[model samples]
Target: MARWQDIEKDAPEFAERVRARFGAGIHKTIATLRKDGSPRISGSELEFEDGEVKFGMMDRSLKLLDVRRDPRIAVHSPSLDPPKEAGEWLGDAKLAGRVVEIPPAPDSPHQDAGHFRIDITEVVLTYVGNPADHLVIESWHEGTGWRRRTRE
Candidate 1:
């Protein structure tokens, strides 16, 4: 797993694109695992602070319980579509990884909520080119640096 800062250092342009989409909005989608191995979708607000991607949840929330039992998680950036006349959509960003639960530090800003740092295993971005051009999809993983593909 790599830190967000490490990714930025290694791939500046790609990291900037992904981070922009991630910061486009606060209410984003998060997928988590339930005890029965089912999937749960919830809203989350992630903070890119101190070179880490972190988030908090209400105490005893289902998502929190899910994280406690299984650390695997996936997060999606909020959608921002361009107008029909425009060709500059900001793109979609996604992050998949394990969550590391950490006790609040003595100097932590948020002490009332449960906080976790994401150990990013995969990051993906999707966007369209010109109207006549194909849609582009790019992905970065822990072992695999970056891969890209296009579709009509």
Candidate 2:
């Protein structure tokens, strides 16, 4: 897995898109593995701080518990339908990795919170094009770096 700093250094262009898409809204979708190995999706918010991507949930929350038992996670930026004219858009983004629990600090403000740091394994950015053109997909993996793909 790759840390946010490494991603930024190794894939600056992709990291910029990830940051833009993630910061476009306050809410995002986080996917975790349940105890029974089923998929669980929870609404969450991401913070890009200290050169890391972090998030938290209420202590003992189902999502929190899910990550504690199984750290694998997938986070998707808030879905925003592209405008009719596609010159600019709140691009689509996704992050997948294992969650690293952050122990509450001695002076922590939210004692009832469970914090997690994302150790990103993959990042994906999807953007729109003209109606006749294909959607552009840019992806980065832990060690594979960035690649571009397109689909109609």
- Which is the leading candidate under TM-score? 2
**Model 1 shows how many backbone clashes?**
0
TM-score of each: 0.91, 0.92
Error of 2 at 27 (Å): 0.5
lDDT of 2: 0.87
Residue pair clashes in candidate 1: none
- What do the candidate models score in CA lDDT, each in turn? 0.87, 0.87
Compared with the true structure, what per-residue lDDT tens digits does model 1 show for residues 37-81?
A: 999999999988888898888787999999999999999999876
What does candidate 2 score in Cα RMSD to the true structure? Answer: 1.7
